[model samples]
Target: MSDASARPKKEKERGKGAGAPRVTARRPTLGHKWLRYLQEVRHELSRTQWPSREEWIRATQVVFGLLIAVGIYIFVLDSALSFVIKGVLGFGR
Candidate 1:
């Protein structure tokens, strides 16, 4: 069941003799809703499992290495293609 459904309904049943406090539905202003949203985000962030410094460093190194390898491959391919094109056009002679 949803959290809202799990919670007891706030509405008072009729013929219940006790003069319970009347529940007033207060509409939250936009600013108040925004603040509440920020609070929820902060709470969720707190629950996150952050990687250790060593793990972060290792991940960064892997990504950087892959990027460097891909860049070198692209550069070499472009250079080879340009050389082939120039040779075909007799530009180098």
Candidate 2:
């Protein structure tokens, strides 16, 4: 049996007596809820493993290097395609 059911019958009925006000559920206010949410966000951020300065710099360098390499490849491909198209059309004449 549950803990409430285990209680004596007289104790259970005492709160339901004539003078007792019926209990109602209360919702949390907006400001109080926002404060609680901010507290939880701060707690989670504190536990995160942020990257070091050196790691961030290295990652940024790798991204830029790849971008330059891809740009060069596209530039070479476009130049070759233009030359081929020009030759086929006899545009040099």
On lDDT, the candidate that comes out on top is 2
lDDT of 1 at 31: 100
Q: Say which candidate scores most in TM-score.
A: 1
TM-score of 1: 0.63
lDDT of the structure predicted as candidate 1: 0.89
Quick one: how many clashes does candidate 1 have? 0
Give the poorly placed runs of model 2, Cα more than 4 Å off.
1-15, 70-93
Residue-level lDDT tens digits of model 2 in 12-84: 3666676666689899999989999999999999999999999999999999999999999999999999899
lDDT, each prediction:
0.89, 0.90
lDDT of 1 by residue, 16-89 (tens): 44676767999999999999999999999999999999999999999999999999999999999989989899
**For each candidate, C-alpha RMSD in Å?**
9.5, 6.4
Candidate 1 lDDT at 62 equals 100
Q: What is the lDDT of residue 41 in candidate 2?
A: 100
Tell me how far the alpha carbon of residue 23 in candidate 1 is from the true structure, in angstroms, after superposition: 10
